[model samples]
Target: MNKFRCLALISATALTLMACNPASDAKPAATIAAPLSATAATPAVTNNSSGKIVVYQAFTRLFGNSNTTNQRFGTAAENGVGKFNDINDAALVALKGMGVSHLWLTGVPHHGLVADYSAFGISADDPDVIKGRAGSPYAVKDYYSVNPDLAVDPAKRLDEFKALITRAHQHGIKVIIDIVPNHVARHYESLGKPTDVRDFGADDNTTLEYSKHNNFYYVPGQAFELPDIPAEFTPLGAEAHPLKDGKFAEMPAKWTGNGARAAKPDFNDWYETVKINYGVKPDGSYDFERLPADYANKNHAAHAAFWQGKELPDSWLKFRDITKFWLEMGVDGFRFDMAEMVPVEFWSFLNSSIKLQSPDALLLAEVYQPQLYRDYVQLGKMDYLYDKVGFYDSLKLLMQGKGTSSEVLAKHAEVADIDQHMLKFLENHDEQRIASPEFAGAAEKGKPAMVVSTLVGKAPTLLYFGQEVGEAGALDAGFGKPSRTSIFDYVGVPAHQGWLNGGKYDGGGLTAEQASLRAFYQQLLKFSSEASALKGEFVSLHPLNLTSPGYSEQQLSFARFDDKQQLLVVSNFAEKPVSFNLQLPADLIKTWQLSAAPVVFTDLFSQHQQSTNPAKQHRLTIELPALGSVVLQRQ
Candidate 1:
């Protein structure tokens, strides 16, 4: 049975039993608790802070829009797009106050959108090839130009973006932008590239199907045909336009972005983009040199030196130059889209070049395969990889009450060796919101998962904008449905607008529950950013507490420690309040150098006090509310 049905059955039985015995002391089945208010007090933290990174991702088009007129398939003018200037000083200050060390400004580059800027010498994108009115951000139209829709003056868009970067730096936040290497828009053009630089496929031999110099894989003698459109759906919501007829002009079709080799891709395929060839031939043989087996242990600098004299593919060189252009523009780092799709050898070259220029540059990738995690991090030199398929998936099941804490512990063990390189997050632009009916169905369910995600390892934590305020992504902004905030259309986020508060960047318009949720996130993030033990060693306490009284697989416990500090973290994924004796194993106690004397344990969030003598008893009584968590520091 599904979790929802199981929960209903249990609750019904509990109510029946309670009716039979009026004097019973058993509490009712737990319901989600109302969150604390805005006036809730934050916990005090130590000054011995470690470099625990927290990244806040904001969709550039939706972050600052306060307009409530969310028309389905609406034009930018009707829906009102957010501008670069809208992310003002107050916004930066608010993000920094939440312990954000980096701000990933998504969808900043000029992409294929269904808008006309003929005055600026840019042609409009055809509706047949665009995903939505705003188009997909992954389909880059120009590598060197900023999106004109985001600027007050279309001609000065790049300058406006640079100014935003300056503002972010002033508030001690580094800037990161998207860098899509595996594909480009089908009609890609670089209007703002450097004088000496050549655009992608500019020097390609289109007649040849497989050449080291060719930019894209082509199907010879085949004319590109548009996919059959659904009768019920129309491009741009049936709005009359010149290019709405199911025809996109491409002769001798190239492969689709998802590597669809057909001349006509399916309607569900990534048909808007053409895949870039990175020296891997059509027959799956490498056209470029492969790395040696022993090179996995080598550092990035060594890999850089190894490629100094070797010849590389034209596509590789083009992407390398594109990255260099952004680095020169003071972009602190890049979030690579589909990094695993490209060869690891190319990453060794590209990432090493980036690190050589800016040693501290952050290189995060979207690689999901568990088998390739170490290759991308250790060999490809990526600083961080998304922990989606493993850690995040396990937590999602646990939040639904359909999975056990033992399963979570096992998943952690799979990547224990490289745990520090895996970044953790519960929501992003691609995932369903935790507050949505499709996921956990309540914002409070994310509290315990958030606590575990932030404190489980030494890797960075990612927070999507509006996640703190409990945005359910319920807007039906055409082409993008509910359960996920739209990235493909012009829309306003209601919950986020409450925090925006008419550009005040305060929670003035937020409800009491939302304000409380934001306060909880603030306290957790502040402690995660400043705690030294979070950056140190970790030991799971699940095994030791499995058979203890009042303990069940619904609760998870762990410990983190370093030379200067020690911490204990526990999260309850149950529907009812959980009371357990969380045991500290002898080995862990020895690592902390604890004596037989009583050691006081203070709850980091509530300041609730408790104590246990290690010699007399190796356990501490823990009580957590439904879907609640606690982080205790050893004193």
Candidate 2:
């Protein structure tokens, strides 16, 4: 019986073959691996075109314990191997000083299993049980490897380790890693032997469903559904369904006496507890018609192909062996994990594998679902994902002050003319905190209406790792209840501060309303990285004079043009001062311009220039203080 117990007793008699249907002519089961060839490979490039970014993606594990050692991107314990050049050259020198390109480190992989390490808060003088415990690096056992306890080498391997996309492309920044291909790891490591145990059911040799490639790819037409459990085989949790923790009694055949072979072959009722198999390839190209070729590593051909999550063939050998194994280590781009459920065949295999690392590789997909620009550009599949309906419709219409700065520059020029569909955001670690109880404190009196949801841009805005240093309470991977994520907070240490802005505010720039909302979000992301018609678009959405009082749900407006330039974004969600109406345009009175309360410009894509003053009035008349916003220019 040894040999991993004959492959766990033929994978536990494949759940008794669902009690009946064994003969559709039965036969196929004893296969092992081989036959794959057609390597071709190389494809995948995307840092998403056009621009506008403050893109942060510093996602620490959402609750469920998160303090991995050599903590991947939070190292500094004097660099015991803190990966990616020890915490990305001090957060890319405060995002190239506010004008950021991209960062997205998320969870760098190689964690075989700590699947839930008793939620890491462990007390009573600590005792790291559960084999180097930590949590949710998206539960992957090995999407290829690399977590040598996160580098400094736990015995090396993973192509020798470390490159972090060439130190974030020497400094142009742009790194993104997460890409977790669905699910795989219920104590994986099973392959073959244990002295054979076949029986797609010649009528119950202790039944078990069919073994080996069993039901082939399940798609005779599509919409599959299988759950028979005639009761008594129990099993529902202990990780069989894999979505992250489960129950229904952990379905081990419901309770056991084998009632109808535990409901016709396992899977407790099903609702995407996560086993996804539909695969069919009449020729569309995901062929697994019935696998049986490889006889046990006689050469490996991916042990006979199977696309598993539908199709995408080696997906550029699976996104170019993790960008040539993080470009040898300089690491630049990959943070995907469940990217719109994967498959544009994997972003046209990542646009031809990062086009020879041109402009420094970037693909970043953890798309936090918000109809992401019509689900990756009108249902075409994916180029990137995470726009939550244009960052919560520009943070819920500038905190319900309801559209106007010309409907917030016509909704950031209607999703900022392509070049990459929205990723812009305001608070992360899923819900709550953009100022707690979920914006119900009007995000600290709408800090300039959530700083115009980060300089109303065209993509790249994410931020979440205690967002600009001010992360308060409540929001441990929300959905409610148990919480514990860490990279140090409840005293383990390291919050550092840096980009949290607003100096003079005691102790530091984070809680004087998060340092005056990080001095208007570091001068509106250093003005969308030096504005070029706000990074594309030579002006549009020019509607002026919006009367106050009610002003369509409190005050929301717009104005972004390019005939020399005009920026007039105003967001005021009530609570006091407000007055609007800027009906100007008499040949620019020699190019009008006005600035007050901290204004600094120069945020680029190609090139831009702005310097303004003079406009106390000219049919113009604005005042937004009291939970406000205003950015007007023309020079």
Candidate 3:
């Protein structure tokens, strides 16, 4: 069973045994819990005009391969200390190497039901899953409880976790966890069964008539519809679609005159469980109350019931509360899951609340694609979402040899128009491997193209697991068990390509190809860290409209500037040699500099650079090889 759903069912069963039944005059679950409110004070926020900007590599499923000298993701063996501390220790070292300011350890709060358990080819009996399988931490079974396997002691788990946060803070590094308030799963019962719970909205009895629900959902003839009236609910089905258009008759019948649907998931599993009317159909399709046997089916009625209830459940309050609780535990921020699902009224309250509790706490949303940003940010006041703009599509184009390197630059600029976000990446637990058959060809240029993703524009870069190293994986990373891919199904690594393949073997260095790629990236990352790069605004390069078919025309140039510093970036997307002219903002010509071999550029990684003026021939013209780019600066 889905762990969180099971846990919730268990919680309700316990509550029913203790709280209500013979209702009316008995004291209720309490009013302070009434109306729904954030559990913590809002955090303080800065106007954030622009300070020393920093980069945070979302190292969620990507960590691990750490020892006392290194830090691994899910290993119970702390690097001579504890798990959190170990992650903090190893991460700091990596940050120093990459010069990153923050580290968003994706969904670190009590989470589990790791994807590899089902996806990475391992039978449950296959010890690898037990060892390597930490289900997606976002499938949270318990908000207050930390994952036992993640902690040395489940009893005092939060304390150790807090220590971990404390240590990371000492390093000047902040952390971010993932949050899920949408449809919770089956495990971790204290929250209650999401599927069976009552949804808010209409007075189904008086409105839609629970008189209908009264008959089959409960004590014979007890209808299971919601309290409010709306569109008739949709029952869960094997597939997610309507057979065709307007085929209302083909829809399934939810009631069929018996308590069948209620019996399926065990309605009594929840103390407040109630089924809703499905209207009528030959095969169910639109009922919010009914659902197919598949797990995590979105229950519109449950959401409706939640909206109707006079007092929000303790668990609901805990959703936002845990963020603060964890912040107190030393967690730096949150990466919310399915952010769009939760009603915005709730989040508006949450954003305001978090500010009072932990001012320094950062918030990241796991929003799908780019279109969803305006609703969340403009109205919801969210901080960041994953950048999926032209990323995957662009990578496909190049590997097929249909697009030039410059296309990557175009895509980045496209995504930035929506938001100066945390640039989402290709390595997360959700996406397929870029080298897999589903994406780029086997040559794996996807990795380098992905490297280009980190630097193409004005967004914060987010690197998911396995992207840095070339780990072989399925077209769908979240698919299923026992050895097809050959990675560790354990909690720490994917089955086919564990840490060794990820290139952090024995603390020395990575594989040769991995090393070369690493060098290239380190250079990009090194420059990205420069104070000017971190805090500057972008200006277009506007290359001349050259009609000649040379490589220089395939390039796109841009500049970043601040009151105190300015840097010009030229990225040549051409695959052949091309000559281009250097066009600088008029005033910059007097102080600008030129670069040569190994590219001695003034950036965060290096200091001491001088400028020189050349004759007209050299002044306006420059030469660049196929597939290359350069950065120049103003003295």
**C-alpha RMSD of each candidate structure in angstroms:** 11.6, 22.9, 14.3
TM-score of each: 0.91, 0.29, 0.60
lDDT of 2 by residue, 1-635 (tens): 00000111112112221111111101111111112222121211333333365566654232112222322222223112233334444455656666667767665664433322223221111111111123334434344454444444444433333454455556676766675543332222211112232211112212222222321112122222234322222112132323323222222222111112222223321111222111212222333333322321222123212323533333234344545655555555565554433333334334334434534455556443332333233222233455554446555555645443444445555554443545556555444444444354434554655556655554556766554544543322111211212322111112223232221112252456555665556566767666655553333313434433335445655555555555666566677887655444444433434334223333232133333333443444556667766666543
Across 135-200, the per-residue lDDT of candidate 1 in tens digits comes to 888889999898898998999999999999999999988899999997899889889998988888
> What local distance difference test score does each model get?
0.80, 0.39, 0.41
Worst 10 residues of 2 by lDDT: 1-10
Residue 540's C-alpha lDDT in candidate 1? 93
Runs of candidate 1 exceeding 4 Å displacement: 1-49, 231-235
For residues 1-635, what per-residue lDDT tens digits would candidate 3 score against the true structure? 01110101111111111122121101112101011211112111232323232445443333543332222222233321124434655556666465555666654554433322223222122111111234434445456655444454545656766776677667766667766664232233332224434322122233222232221122234333322211111111122322212121201112211112332222212211222222221132221222112211222233233334333323334455656666666676676764643434355446545644765556666544344444444334455566653665564576556765456556666655443544445555445455565555342454335434554444555654455555445421121221112122223333213323333332244566655555555566655655445344665554332432342435556667667766656555445656756555544443334333122234322343533334421133445555555555555
Candidate order (TM-score): 1, 3, 2
TM-score of 3: 0.60
Ranking by lDDT: 1, 3, 2
Which regions of candidate 3 fall more than 4 Å away from where they truly are? 1-62, 65-90, 112-134, 153-156, 191-316, 369-371, 390-400, 403-418, 422-426, 435-437, 441-452, 455-457, 474-509, 542-549, 552-554, 572-627
Q: What is the number of residue pairs that collide in model 1?
A: 1
